[model samples]
Target: MHNDCIFAIQLYFMQPVTGFSKLSKSQKIDWLVTNHLNDNATARETLTQYWNEDQKLQDLHDGFSENTVTNYYFPFGLAPNFKIDGQLVTIPMAIEESSVVAAASKAAKFWMDRGGFKTVIKGTKKVGQVHLMYHGLSSEMDAFYAFAKAELLQSLEQINASMKKRGGGIVSLDLIDKTKNLKGYYQLHATFETKDAMGANFINTTLEQLATTFRLKASQFDGFSSDVPEVIMSILSNYVPECVVNVSVSCKIDEIGTINGVTGKEFARKFVQAVDIATVEPYRAVTHNKGIMNGIDAVVIATGNDFRAVEAGVHAYAARDGQYRSLTKARVENDTFIFEADFPLALGTVGGLTSLHPLSKLALQILENPSAEHLMKVTAVAGLAQNFAALHSLVTTGIQAGHMKMHLVNMLEQIGATDVEKDLLRKEYADKTPSFSALRESLLVLRS
Candidate 1:
């Protein structure tokens, strides 16, 4: 217990500084390991190279597989002060984006001043779908679903021996009849609690075997081609998945007011209005969702889950309402701003890169083997923070006010401008309308 406490404290203080270039490789690695549990010397040594990996990274000419290249995870940090339902929690995120981490952290701090975040995580259940297309079986759809459910359960008992031992088995089968459409498709949704694992890979393998076994059992004399010809896709469906995590944050208006002239209530109302833009417009929602993912993807990679899978599911879920919109809802009521975000989080406790990645294993240790529900809880908080940061920036100043200035310095330096020359250009471009010719002339004047 003492060691765990010490490690936890160490994790809090080991947060990376804002300006990353100042830190030595060893220092960065130490920070990564202390906070994330997944840092190593190799990651530290190649940190700069990793930053450039997206570009200059060439195809592996020799023996390395495509998986090797795509699987290299980037860890970014989001440190936010938060009190979740009076329980103080510091969120450490690993993402790769310009403003995502900062935005989320700021948002967390804002909500902490009120009453903090409150979350309720449902059971970590995943749904895998088995779709079969039958050609000449207009009347067989009903019978086929019934037989498939029993066979699927039996297969679940055989293959998911571990789940059964742990008192978890295939719970039920939900049949979706979309026969009015082309080819008359049948979707069998297998719902089950996976205990700890994400269960996609395991479930996929099980479903594939079950589909073949069930077809054979239905018609033992010959192949069941005419009746149930082929299985279109026997895998997981991100649609209406059972795995969900719901999180909400409530804080008084006074908690949001930092400006001397502005009351907290007024600030909260303005912030609410800013977030509403994302809810109403798809254009704003895209970037808004991206900011949320910035924090999510980092943790996903750090924990060795399938980030791409989660991303695909989230965007699709966003459009599920017929109109593309925000995944989160925010409002200012009474003296408090209430925020809630819920999404399909099909994260597993084991398998995939979770076992393969060295850093992912270490990061998981930092969270103390959090359940899927707990992980989703953290993700919800992070998303809230990200949304807060974005709205705060846009509402107060403007999108590019700070970011553009920083980028300009980088641009000036890249163009061989000395510190003195860069300073001159920054002053000249403060209006943000400097011509290339004017910049070139200024550079010449500075050199002289």
Candidate 2:
């Protein structure tokens, strides 16, 4: 009965048209032919228009005047069949490459057939830093903290009032004195529970407010000599202090055997090994980190998170071992492939063009109004799933087979293969090989 229930879940989510996993090369050709000849043109056009409208809105918000590099249009595809923890979710991703959406979708389907992915998220706390660079206050550090404590607390209270109604708010503050490079620099750390928002802009803005109040109070003090210390950088720490999200998945061997030669558990083990290599060595870590970012960057583009900030934080964290490491780790345990990804994700929820980009706003809405913390947790899970898909392909079929087949379309186009010629060549080369030399030879023969 448990097995039957699992089957039903898989059927509901994946809804794959093909029942048998194996097919002749001719059969695959035929399938492609049917999709091209009989596909829904009107539906495709509608989607194109939707994305165009989104692009226009993005342009307006970003202030693109035609010569700017701000407008980016990546391929937006939906991973249609995902049942994570018994809940169906259609993940929307904007990426330029092929295979990723399909790979993740198929993996999610396999997990669904076995048992589906389960997830947990830890408590949410955001950290903000205040740099106090005042001369001669080094000796009076204790007095300085005391002088600024009440007003800072009051500032947090006002910030928390709105948050308190939403079931979260500013919780605590920490202070540190003295720095090596910058003499007479004191740091006051503010830890706030940002709830679902990424709380970056929120936390930074709040810290700026407190810093202003502290500066005013410091001027009135007798021992304080430095000009109301101007805040150099006020922003939330990416090292999220709150407990983040956790997810786990299990898939049966028979279920995975449907796809190819290896068992699900074996694939899981190889994936773990690959990720482990990335964690320990810089040589493999670059590609491993790329795979993690492949997932994260797509999601960030979709939801309008500062992808650059995410990239910066992740790459910085990767180099923590004096060398870079993979942002994700994978393992096999108890008939399951366990994957985890944690890095500094300094995302903001409300501020900037997040409110400006219409499609970005739509992307956020599709995610069910996720808070900043919730978004990070979900981001981690998505990265894990994507990493698994990439490594599994690497270990099993050797990643290039499917990838190159898709690239053939581009290679043909690059050599100036027309639509008709491309389709004919693709059909002729059913084995999925791009014979550019052959095409050139054929062109010469036809001229003769």
TM-scores of all predicted structures? 0.75, 0.75
Put down candidate 2 lDDT per residue, 1-448, tens digits, no spaces.
Answer: 5955765565566545573336542344344434432344554444334433465564584463332322446777777566665767666677887776676676666666766666665555667788877666566667877777887788667767887887766778767776676776778887876655556666777888878877777777777565555556666666553544566565444345624687666766667788888889888888877777777787788887778767776787778667778877666656545666655565556656567667777777777766776566556656667777777778888788777776777677777866867677777666744456876665444446
> For candidate 1, lDDT tens digit of each residue in 1-448?
6877777777777655685545554455565654666444465556445443433233321122321222345544536467766776655566645556666666677666667778877655667877877666555666665655566567656688877787665666776666787656777767777666777767787778767765666664243346554568788665544566777877666666564355667667777776688888999889888877877777776677778888888788789878778888888777667877877777765776676545666667666677766767776677766666666666666667655654565467667887777877888889774445667777888788
Best by lDDT: 1
lDDT of each candidate versus the true structure: 0.67, 0.66
User: Clashing pairs in model 1?
Assistant: 37-362, 38-359, 76-94, 76-95, 94-298, 198-348
Give the range where candidate 1 is weakest over 10 consecutive residues by summed lDDT: 61-70
User: How good is model 2 by TM-score?
Assistant: 0.75
